[model samples]
Target chain A: MTAIPVQPIVSMRRVEKIYRQGDSVVHAVDQVDIDIFPGEFTVLSGPSGSGKTTILNLTGALDNVTRGDIHVEGRKLQDMSRTETSRFRRDRVGFVFQAYNLIPVLTAFENAELILSIQGVPRTERSARVRDLFHAVGLDGLEHRRPSAMSGGQQQRVAIVRAIVTNPAIVLADEPTANVDSRTAATILDIMERLNREMGNTFLFSSHDPQVIARAHRVISMQDGRVVGDERRDGNS
Target chain B: MLILMAFRNLWRNTRRTAITLFSIGFGLMLSLIFTGIGDSGYGRLIEGASRMGMGHVALIPRGYLDTPSIDKRFDVPSDLIGRIQVMSRVTAVRERITGQAMVATANDSAGAAFMAIDPGTETPETLYFMDFLESGALFDPKNRIGIVIGRNMADRLRVDIGGKVVYTLTDVQGEIISGLARVSGIFRTGVLQVDNYFVLLPIDTLRDLIGYTSREVTHLAVFLEDHAASRSIRSRIQACVDEIPGAEAVTWRDAMPDIAGLIAMDQSSNYLFQLIIFLLISAGILNTILMSVLERKREFGILLAVGISPLRLFSLIMLEAGWLCIFGLIAGLLLTAPVYGYLHSTGIDLTAMFTEKPDVGGVLFDPTIHADLRPISLAVILTVAAALILLSGIYPAWKASRVMPVEAIQSA
Candidate 1:
């Protein structure tokens, strides 16, 4: 008997995202096909002008596709309306912005639980989830501190907790460790890898740092808006 | 949580929020005060016109307002008078026979407006003119032909207390009738029109001279407890007046258009001034909201990137404006209460503001003005201010909601 085929959590075919600047045209993301399966810690490693973040944005429905088909969790990104895409983003995918964009007015705990709250989760359950994730990330006693009051590593750990608190199907992190020192970045990467390996959380990170790329289960190296190589370094997938 | 965030956002710059709140609170306070002044001023003028024999409302013969003549007279029964007197706002109901006549003494003759009143029914409280007598009494209770003339008319006709005079007019049959009267009182009202032309006499004497019964007077004056009550009572008594053939109930406004029109014009000017202040306050509101939205575009982009709906962001901004409105109104009420109370109780003497007491259409008003803060006026100002704030909030909220998350996040 044939084993049933594994469905990809994210599927992209012939995706093209172009930009027009003054009189010149830019192919920010050229025609490309890629698939990211469940529980795979993948990284799109590229230079500054490469299209790794664009692909991540398209998958999370943060930006619209110029021309192509992208399916996250088997739902077509192009078929979703503005409200539907918002719900899809709300329920299916999470983001870790490079700036650690925690709302300055809210405490760290409040920031971590913000998405679950928006999803109409009960207060008790949200608190329990946020605390559980905070403890897992080694941020046990810093829940009440705001982003401004915490160190870069603590804030990023809180951001990671925020990203996966709802257990979304996928987490898109763009240059997540780009702001801090190398030591802090290593700590953030270690925490993210621990969550991925131990808890089976899928992660798709975009970064050029060799440290981050080395820790991924698979690395998709890109250059000039085109994928140059795809390598799997582990047997997890 | 959204409300808490919105409320907390306002104090990011405490001084700016305080100043904006002050503008709103002060504008609302000024609106309240202006309304109070207009209400009080109009009340005084309307009462003055009502007490000058036009009453708050009157039951007059049809076409009498346009062409008042004894020939067009109608009679109202005693039971109708009693019924009107029992109505909600009616204070006193009295009968009168008014006409235009010529009064002459041995030295000269002058044209005069005659108001024939009943001594048994008219009092100083009912007839404000009776209180301003410079000399003598308000017509004789015993003498049939006793009359009261203004000081100017008395001077013009060369008559005084117990002075002999004669009045001539055309009666209902189109025949000229004459009567001999003694000037028993002289009044000086400081109004040139009234002091120069008015003549007061007893109703029975004019009825006798005109050859008419007690019910056949020109009109029945219906005084009220408050002059503004005429608005409702006139329509209410119209059906009752419709029962009497050829009779109609007329408000003091329709009876005395000169005073009513002037009051209306003054009120319009007051409202226009208040509208300018409200527009300025709205501009301030727009500035406050727009700045707050513009300063937080990146934060909003982050929110949208995460999964907060655009509509929810819009609601958040609107809630911010709503909080401003609520807080501003609280400050306004707290600021205006003591000032309004002082004006209502121990009013400011406006004698310094004017050389003399203000007069409208020959009606003298008080120099010391008081505020009348009607409940409806308060409700209307508050509602209007709240509506203006919400209207001003829409543009900023829309701008914030329409932010492109990618462009915004990348820009910063």
Candidate 2:
């Protein structure tokens, strides 16, 4: 008998995203089907305008799917109302931006605690969870530092902590390593992989950087708004 | 978190925020000074009109204020006078006879309106003869024919402080009468109407000359501790008049409608000016807030993507406006207090600005301007300012709320 397969945390079915440029319709994302499984560290690698970030956005419920369905943690994103969609994003998926967009007014711990606070987690528990995560992510002493005071790599690490604090269905990072140096990018990839291994957290990244793509257990390649290749590999190939 | 982020975001662009704050503060300070000056100036004009002999509240023969002459006289109701003198806000009650007369010096003659008074029976603080006496002495109680005249009348009549003059008028029986009097004092009021046309006589002397009994006078003038209390006090005095017969109570506004009209007109113009200034400042502030919001589109996107609701984002913007209003009001008060202090105290002389004498509808204003900011006026102004500033933020806040995370993030 065949082994049973674990349910995928996120699944997209032939999704198409269309855009209107006044006089013309552009297929920004077309004929794309993807499944991001639990504990999978995956990369959607492509050149500019290749719809990698678009796919990540669709999975994160940050953008609407045009013609097909997207199920994140088994909740249909397009069918969600505005409030429900926001709650879905809040409770399910976490996002890490390429620019390390930490709220400048908040300290690192506070930044990581923001989602939990929004979820109405008690203050002491929020503090406990944020502190433990800060320690686990190698950001032990910088919990109180604002984004402006930290190095770029350290800021990205805090951003990762912010993304994974809820153990969400997937952490969608759009070009997460683009702005950092190679060594810092390596460190970020290491921390992200460690998060997946130790916590069973799922992550989906959109990056054209070969170094970042090389560390992912699965690589989905796209060009001209179409998926052209899918390669699954053993760890750290 | 919303408020914290809002206040911190304001400081992120410190120079821009400071510049915007300065604009708000400067506008508010200017408004306070303008309004303060208008209040004090109107008060000064009103008191000046009152002292010119309207009093704050007055009781006269039923038709005296409408058409006045020495013939329309009333007996001094001692009971009514005593009742009013003891009224809570009453400062003093004065008896006076006002009539048009002719004063002829040995060398010259001019028409004058004479007011007969018993010395020390009026608001001493506002008595023109007592306060602005330029030379000589006030009337001696023993001398029945002593009088005081203004400097311009003295000049027009070609008389010295002690010069002899004759006053002529028609009394109650419609008979012409003349009495000889010595000028005991001369006062300069800097008001052309008062200085050129007014004369003060002893009550007994005028009564005897005009063939009136001791208790009969043309008018009874009631003074108060505060002139602004005139309306309410007038009602109280009117209620007393209703109890008695053959008299009517009138406020200075009714007694001197020209002065009241002038003040109302001036205040309306001042309000219009303030409204214009408020609109301009609101526009500048609105634009500043919009630019601040537009610049942070992507930041707002990051927030929205992280699950901050649109309503929360809108509140964050409004909180920013509230904070801006608070800071601006504080800054404005800091700038205004000292200037209002100096203006209210030492006052700023406006003599040079007076190409002509500072008279409006026969009333003279002192050249120096004083500020009189009421506490309620300050609260009203601040509340209005805060409302406008907050109103200025609504559109920007709505715009912030409607931000699309994908487009906004990609736009960056």
Q: Can you give the DockQ of every candidate in the order shown?
A: 0.65, 0.58
Quote the lDDT for B389 in model 2: 91
TM-score of chain B of each: 0.92, 0.90
Docking class of 1: medium
The number of clashing residue pairs in model 2 is: 0
lDDT values for all models: 0.88, 0.86
Model 1, position A47: C-alpha lDDT score: 94
Q: Lowest summed-lDDT stretch of 10 residues in model 1 chain B? A: B354-363
For candidate 2, write residues B50-70 as lDDT tens digits: 776768988888888777877
Candidate 2 at B276: error in angstroms? 3.6
Q: Over the stretch B258-367, how does candidate 1's per-residue lDDT look in tens digits?
A: 98898889988988999999999999999999999999999998888888889889998999999999998998888888888988888888778876546777787787
- Per-residue CA lDDT of model 1 for A62-168, tens digit only, reads 88878889988788989888889778877878889888988888889999998899999999999999999999889889988978999888888888898899888
Tens digits of lDDT, candidate 2, A1-237: 999987888888999998889999888799888887888989999899999988988887788988899887788889898888788778788899999999888898889998888788898998898889888878999988999999999999999988888777789999999999999999999889988899888889999999988898999999989999888897333
Query: How do the predictions measure up, each by TM-score?
Result: 0.92, 0.86
